[model samples]
Target: MLAKSFALAALASAAFASPLVVPVSGGDTPPADQVTISGITTSGTGCPQGSVGQFLSADRETFTLIFDSYQAQIGPGTVPTDARKFCQINLNLHYPQGFQYSIMKTIFRGYASLQKGVSGTQQATYYFSGESAQCSTKSTFTGPVTKDYTVEDDLTVASTVWSPCGADLPHQYQVPDHA
Candidate 1:
């Protein structure tokens, strides 16, 4: 099990990105048809070049990212870097007129294996490019286990921070390199 191997497409890039934000305004759902992902890019120690990428479904409501080398392991002989890895993914999206979005929730699914006394963590931070305000979520795994996992960050309506409209912004998800 790779603990925090950072690259995530099914590990949800746009899924994580879309999985990260949904457009809305005036209590109306943003036109799904008008919202489309324009671009996506990822970088991190958890995601070296070519180790991550994204795929969008035909209906445009869903997408997944596949990571080949994003994994973490810790034991004798394992390097320090094996214990944690992270990918920062940016999704540039076009929104409908007069509409903006908020990340109500995000689901991160992954494989994990841990020995007693150790723990794992996966985190995502959502923010618009060049903006100081942001929203973040985190999930933690304690050791003495090995299995698949799904971590969801569900934000309360009051707590949800929305993406501002009228500008081309890249929705960014990340675990800071030092974290």
Candidate 2:
């Protein structure tokens, strides 16, 4: 009898411990209506000249960014073993109006594609959970609750020998402009 009682208590605790999961529309590539492109900035050696694109959901609930393509180096020396091409991406959530909340945790769902010395692709899906924080007196409430994350795994063309190279052959994130 005692064992059965303990089992019931454990089950109750487990149920309460589970967090509430919020459902979002965009899985990886957010639908057109669910995103807005604010601005994009690109800087790097691999693809120094690049562009930025963004998507903000119509309701302002979700935000996503794509940092085109940037040039990067994968190996050593001016003539690296591989000249990697990559890009950066970000997907996050925004607080709904009149609602107060704090993010307790964030989950990233996606895949990474690495092409030996060339271009690659990266996909990201973000899930967030938090406690409610009443938004009453606050005059201004803006921006995402979490950090602006980046994923640079895409490479364009691979080179067995680094023919065209530069001093800055590393990966770096550019500050995106707001739309």
Top-lDDT structure, candidate number: 1
lDDT by residue for model 1 over 1-179, one digit each (tens)?
A: 44433222236433454433344445666666777877778888777789876787776665677776676666665678766677887877777656766556666666766667766667678777788887777777676766776676777767666677677677787853221
User: TM-score for every candidate vs. truth?
Assistant: 0.80, 0.24
Off by over 4 Å in 2: 1-50, 75-179
lDDT of 1: 0.65
- For candidate 1, report its TM-score: 0.80
lDDT agreement of model 2 with the native: 0.24
* Candidate 2 worst ten-residue window by lDDT: 3-12
lDDT of 2 by residue, 1-179 (tens): 11100000000011111111122332343343433223323343322353534444454433343333322223224243233333322222222222222222222222222223322222211111131211111011122121223222222122111111112121112221110
lDDT of each candidate versus the true structure: 0.65, 0.24
Model 1 CA deviation exceeding 4 Å by range: 1-10, 13-15, 19-27, 176-179
TM-score of 2: 0.24
| Residue 69 error, candidate 2, Å | 1.4
